[model samples]
Target: MANIEQAATYYEVKKAEDVSRLISKYAGQGKTNKVIWLALIGVFIDAYDLTTLSFGIEQVITEFSLSPVMTGVVASAIICGTIAGNILGGWLTDKIGRYRVFMADMVLFVIAAIVAGLAPNVWVLIIARFIMGISVGIDLPVAMSYLTEFSRFNGRSNKAARLAAWCPMWYAASSVCFAVVLFLYFLLPEEYANWLWRVSLIFGAVPALLIIFIRGKYLTESPIWLANQGNLKEAVKILNESYNIPALTKIEYAQAVQIKPSHTGFAVLFNKTYLPRMIVSIVIHISVAFQYTTIAFFLPSILSRFFHTDTLTTISTTLGLNLLFAFTGGLLGVYIASRLTSRLVLIAGFAIQFLALLSLSLIGQPENSFLLYIAIIMLGLWLFAEGFGPGAQMMIYPTMAYPASIRGVGVGFNRAVSGVAQATALFLLPIWMAKYNTHVFLIISVFAIVPILVIGFLIKFEPTAVDVDAVVENDNIIKNLQHQISSQ
Candidate 1:
């Protein structure tokens, strides 16, 4: 009887320690800076792959002898594929795990890039581009989920900083790609122009390859995920290695075993407690979708229409502006987002975008050089605001609002919605711009204003600069506890 009692006591103590370690790991206090950087590298590659087509579109058209409408269709194809991929990827991330999804997606992107470069006809190019879009679409949600989950172990504020730094790396890569393409075009003969475009397509694969190796070398499964799976021992082990915590024994595990909120599906997002925030998140995403498609995707054509410049000059100028504004805005957005409320940053971004659009609409008539410069500067400011605000806001919202269990789904839903908006805008905006000119900008400006008011005035939650775990715990326990008790 004495021996049996002693064994039973030992088991109980061991179990308790296991639980304690699990909690610590899931709470995100144990991850290293190196883990964060590797994840960011994956995101950088994802961004580069997504933006590469914008620079390659002109060359694609000339090589294929395709019409402007066809070019729009090609661009729209990727966005459409991305929408589908985002939903699938989000589901898969939760189902399969982040590392698996991330690594696989990179391979898909690399394959798509190589195929796109080798395409013999326009249809093949379209197919390849669509596939590439799908891969990036998957990467965005999975990568963001990975970043959010891992960073949470450290702090949400750190996550914001990491995203701010890494997200703009995409724009920087796009700029570099454009410069390289231009140089290659100049260096190579017209007979080899198609080859240069092909080479550019293949270049999209490089970052993915680099990230794949890095991820393979260093990436670990999310500890939060491990806890959710009831694998406390493994979760604790990861925490020890990641955060430099000493090994936890069973006694610690039992003391720390508290049930966290479930975060697995669409239901988590639509739960009564999270519903209003969900609406706010959806609106923010839609607003960004509208703004991004109009400014980033359509700006070149708009310039061409207004300036009556040759295609090369229009593309070159647009690429230059994209590089400048995207980089500046990305960096600025990171800074402001880290310092201010995401809601305020978003409102400010829309306000800036609206003003820039209005200014461009009023002054951007044909052959108006002074107006052109004004438009460029204002647009740059607008992009800057987007980078600091919407870009960062998008990264923050789903992660902040959802618990770990359902975070992937929430982010995936948000990304998928944004992708749909982008696809639709790309398909329809060209026709509208051709018909209405400045009126198109005016219409987009009006849409941008509505969200600013709704988010600024109606929404009550503020997520900026808060402790991520504390916020999640408070939001989950206090707000949700109240919600549960009230519902009963």
Candidate 2:
């Protein structure tokens, strides 16, 4: 299907710098918003799959006759799956291409959601959730890469703002999950109430399948990624399609005719330029995961036990908190990203969390309706701070910290650390809650305390409006830097 002139144009592109310049020229133009939204839909399903069990966890324990330990295992299975998925998916995204890996993970989402909903036993459910976790894990790195690569480096709706969008989408998914649970609570007969978890999980597949269908028509390869991999012609074509830029392949000449191999592997992330960012990202992600998993994942149960509320009331309260406070916080994060450093927001977030958790710990069990309302207010404050702070920064640091070459690995590694924290928190939370009741907030408060204390020291660089990838635009310098790092 290739004509002589068109085929010849593919070879006309010789310098990677020119490709980067062309992409930058039209960075915020054309179908960029549509492409970004399609990528964000992936984030929505990921958050939905991750939180599907939160509302129905008690039902799962009751239906399966599970012990505290088994309940923890079943609840944390998807998180455990993400640890593996993040590592493998990150590598594959960089090794292959973002579009291929992105498309493949969407399919996994469809399959895993279907299987999870139809699971026959606890073990089957666990397996299905684990598979779903992997899909989520794989999707995030690619999705984050898409978010970062597709947008401009600075100004309004820059990479940081775009990256922060994931948090609101994440809360949106959580709110939607709870809404579905509420609808099911009313729709299902009293006798069939236990089936709530199954149907809620199946709903996740609808969005995933819809994304798969729409993606084929709208999704294009990341031009930056293609250019990094030395595929200039394809990269320029995508630029033309997504950025409304004129095709550059027809140019008769180029600045230079040098080709550069892509820089990948986890080793580079530990080099002097990136190691600090990695440490900060991992610490914040893990801390956020520990706090979020114990609180958000167990919110329904926490409310049910603390207030002696029925299932319907617990679901409604959890839904309201997520929508009103948590989702609103996420939107605030998106709004402030263009104006504030992620570090400042994170510090504010962690400080508020520490105070909130400490207050909850001191309050103990609510002795009256007034105390109960106070406790709810504290919980809302924590979620609100988390929405804009750690939740948004956790993704921002890893995705923006590293350049395109190791961005996938950086985010994947950070996510894997968070996965471990989430698993540990989920596993220990029930045991802690049983022994300490509201005092368990004391233990959770430490996660918040540590991040506030350490974040200031660990993270010095601001990725908010910086072009981190351009730092390594010269291939020879990267090779020399890697050589120095390896030799040492």
Give the top-scoring candidate (lDDT). Answer: 2
Write candidate 2's Cα lDDT for 274-295 as tens digits.
8887887878888898889877
RMSD of each: 5.6, 5.1
Query: Residue 147 lDDT in model 1?
Result: 65
TM-score (C-alpha, index-matched) for candidate 1: 0.86
After superposition, the stretches of candidate 1 with alpha carbons farther than 4 Å from their true spots are 1-31, 67-69, 152-157, 247-263, 310-316, 465-477, 480-488
Cα lDDT tens digits for candidate 1, 1-488: 01123223232223322333333234345455666666666676666666666656666777788775887788788887888788888888877677788889888988999998899999998898889878877887777766655553233445565555654766676666667677777888887866766887888888788777777556787766665555566666766777554544364663465544445567767778678867888888788788777877666666666666775676577667766787877877666655666777778878888888788777757356776678778767767777766776777877666655666787788888888888888777877777887678787887679888888788767654444433443465777788999999
Best by TM-score: 2
Per-candidate clash tally: 27, 0
Q: How many clashes in candidate 1?
A: 27
Q: Which window of ten consecutive residues has the lowest lDDT sum in model 1? A: 1-10
